[model samples]
Target: MKRVLITVFAAFIALTAAAQSPIVQAHLEPSHGILVGQPIRMVVTVYVPNYFTGSPDFPEFEIENAIVVLPQDRPANSNTQIDGVRYAGITETYVIYPQQAGDFHLPREQVTVPFALAPPKSTIAQVPLPALAFHADVPAAARDLDYFLPTTALTMQQKWSSPMKNLRVGDTIERTVTVTATKMQSMLIPPLSLDAPSGIRVYPEEPVIHDQKTDRGDFVYGRRTQTAKYVIQKEGDYTLPSIELKWWNLSSHRLVTATLPAVHFIAAANTNYVTELPPESEPAPIAPIRHRSLWKQYRSRILITSLCCIAVALLLAMIWYWLPRARRRLQAWQERRRHSEATYFHNLQRACTQNNAAESYVWLLKWIAVADPGVSLQQALKRADNPLLTSDTNDLGESLFAQRIQDYSWNGKRFAALLRQQRKDHRMHLSKHQYLNDLNPK
Candidate 1:
């Protein structure tokens, strides 16, 4: 009887501890029929016994031969009942793209969760995430292609910077090609080859690639833009090669090809075209004797002139190097001073001295903001408790918003004087308060 009781007591304690511990669950969506360069969703859910005091710390991890994307949206909240006990849960999603066909495994990781054990009592728990495995393979139909693109939709567009119909030997034209794909990454799109005929010169620019995402952080589409400039080197009719991109359509499960048509144009010989000429022939050997005679006669003057030229060149080089740096420093300093509190106060005083009601009101608001942040202008005025300042400010407002502007006139000078007096009184009151606080210990 004693042995049986001891065994039952140990079993009960084990069950109680298991009930209080946190739980972690992970799984993949569409676990079968995954293709290369396709995105898969990985959902991870964490649950605590009572309620969560703070969000769970989900770790970011990487898998070999694949691209991992962390959750872009906030965690989804959920509640579930397990073994007759309620559990509060949060779910976070991840996106993974396999670059090649292989088996991928997600290693175990640790997640920290903060939750309330009871009302007003909180604790943190470290939960272990279980390992997950998945497989990706290339479709037999897409095996022959050099690059694999698995998407629901794909499109290609072309634009020219100028008309391609003109016939000129020295004229140049720019051609831009844009490729857009749905449910794929921009980096997976292959580059377009812009090869021109032998007679034409081709200069290819760097390609621009980006992806667009929805508000919840899901990828909407990917776009790739390429540009090339063609210059007409010789006069003749030239034909540019066409471009074709092959991709696998995920919806139809078939291969699709997007093409841009070829371009043909005629180039006529330009009459105004000028060819580079050979450099002038060097002076004959016999001419150096005459040059040497002249050089000997003015050698001292030539030396002096050359030294002066060198000094001037040095001075210009120094100024060229230092001028830009000095200008940037000066501009930065001026910007800082322009936004200072003292500058705003000075502007207010100037506006009030000129008796410009509109300008004075604008500067008054600015100065008040710098003086006391989070306190309204009316509140500050009430705290000052000055009847004259209040009356002048009211008159200033009337001048700004009155139906008839000529009906009311404001005295900015009196307002400025009263404002200064109120500031002095406030400062004196603060000094007295500080003195009293220092005199008595708390």
Candidate 2:
């Protein structure tokens, strides 16, 4: 009977290994060299037999020195039959932008997928699929441009409610510039700079961005609009400088420029403007009389008073600049001390749970040092003079450094319990003192 059971178990293992495994594959799109800061696509696919129901859990990827972003788009799913066997599969894509010009490899990872293989799909099994890897490089061509983005097409246009011609002082004109790019994200587009001629005050609003896709959702396009309100300051002729955007054209395999035309306008003074002048007045001449001794008598006292006032002002200014900074430094120091104390205590507890006598002793010493730098663990235990804590520490020490055949066991549970009780009592006493001090602070 035992032999038969062993044979059946071996057959089960063989069946699972041969018949239930899913096909896993990975690849990089546009799999060659790409410019730095240009996005590359990583695709992972899992094909399971039709008997398996449900999807696979794709792993999250994080690469050093590269920006990896999970695609917001949904994964593609399909069903196909190959060699008279039906299969279902899903494909997931991720976007990555290399930050530096160097070779990088995405490591392979095994993923476990949960699926049901029976009718009504009640029973489930987790199958580990094969790992996948990808490699790419940023070549010397990437260093030629400071900022690079590959796109299919780009366009820019400026629109306004009225023509920018023959405007008066204080007149305001609103102009909008819109940029559209195909097969690219709006965030990759650099900010547009529009230089304004002298005598024009420009108040610009935030740029509005929009992303859209085709009806079939195959192609994506992004639009960004920047608006500004230009106010005529001095009445003179001015020209709005031309704006140009340089982008790499994917189809043409070269750089192209999208241009916005320059605008010229005349701002004339308002004809009905009026100017007011101050009223004219004739002043009477004063006869000069001076008391030189009276001025000299009080000059020394006045100078002394002014000097004292200046010294007080200087002291106040110094205090105003440095008091807040000193307070912040003090706060930061206290926070660090609190965090260190908490971490040391937690390490002690963890060491005790693992029944590591040497580690526990070291963590106990560290906790005492952080809590009160002047006290050692042995000294603290003696000063507390608690029977339970002292006994527990003695047992732990003996277990760590025993002489009789090393036949000692550390009671971690009892030690931890006694330490917790001691800490609770210490906190209560400390809190009482703090409360009393707060009531009558000196």
Candidate 3:
């Protein structure tokens, strides 16, 4: 029984260690024949003994004279058995395009992987990537081409903004050319030559290049659009030169030339066109140069000077006449505003709202004096018959004048409310008294 237990424990430890070990595999899709500007798939797969706790950090590497593309797709997952032990695997793919005919090598790099050996016990492992190499050469048929574009298919189309017939001078016509290809990048597409013949002006716009892909993140095709506007400067027959592009077709394994046919158009002279008169035509008689008297020459200056003088005189007279009257009116308005009971009451309300005890007391005295001249604050409060107003005013006076602690605080919200009510009642009483006197005519 003791020997059996020891064997069981040792077997479990060996299984655990084997499950935690990670393996990395990398290889090019086609290790044999490759052509320049052709995309080659490089797939890297990572395997862990049990399961993955976190995503594996794949290293990005570049090859000389080649372009690499890593598609933004989810990593492929699978399950397999290695040496009778269950293992989880993740596969990622990268595309590489060789730009020149040469030998390309992928250097070895490290990939960080996090996986679980057993439930709730996960660990990270650094795995080294396997080295890869491939060779690319240009085919015999495409050797003479300056620019090599390898694609499965290619197509070109052209359109005009308006009809090319019956064009008149100064008319503008725009031409647009679009090139599309599969298994290629739009940036690799070259620009078109849209040169116009003499008597027409060409204004070429910047080319637009974009790539399209399916919902599964698979490359569909690449498209490039170019536009140019031709303006008719003079009336004549014009021919826009044809455009040609040479590319290597991967499907046929041969060089293909796509051509845009030449366009021809005629422009007619405009009937309403005006041009400089020829010297042979008789010249019109020159207008006689006339002489003027001194008064005529300076007539505008004389009138301006006279008007300015009259305006100055009028302005001076108006100021001299209205200055004293304006001063007198201003003085009268100031006196009325100073004696207004409403102004004094407004100042009092402002001071109370600000919670300024001393300022509130001073304004209260002034307001009471204005409401009833020669009356004291206490007398005014008593005559108003507002007990709440009287109480609040007394509190305010105590806060300002009475001896109190240094930390004493005062709130003016209640006092301001009571003051407003007292003012309203006093105004009502005064209005009633005035109405009765008017009826009695005493």
User: Which candidate number would show the highest lDDT if scored against the true structure?
Assistant: 1
Q: Please provide, for model 2 over 266-369, each residue's C-alpha lDDT reduced to its tens digit, 9 standing for 90 to 100.
A: 89997653333345679878879765786588999989999999999999999999999999999999878755878878877877877766657656755776
Residue 288, model 2: lDDT of 97
lDDT, candidate 1, 221-310, per-residue tens: 999999999988789989898999999999999999999999999999998865445568998777444445777899999999999999
Clashing pairs in 3: none
Native-referenced Cα lDDT, model 1: 0.82
Q: Give per-residue lDDT, candidate 2, residue 209.
A: 89
Looking at model 3, which ten-residue stretch has the lowest summed lDDT? 400-409
Stretches off by above 4 angstroms in model 2 are 1-19, 35-41, 60-88, 93-110, 116-146, 213-219, 271-442
A best-first ranking of the candidates according to their TM-score comes to: 1, 3, 2
Q: How many residue pairs clash in all the candidates, one count each?
A: 0, 0, 0
Which should have the higher lDDT, number 2 or number 3?
A: 3
Overall lDDT per candidate, in order of appearance: 0.82, 0.69, 0.79
Per-residue lDDT of model 3, residues 357-423, tens digit only = 6557656655765677655555577687877777777676455434333544456877888889877
| Better by TM-score, candidate 3 or 1 | 1
TM-score (all chains, Cα) for each model: 0.64, 0.50, 0.56
Candidate 2 lands at a TM-score of: 0.50
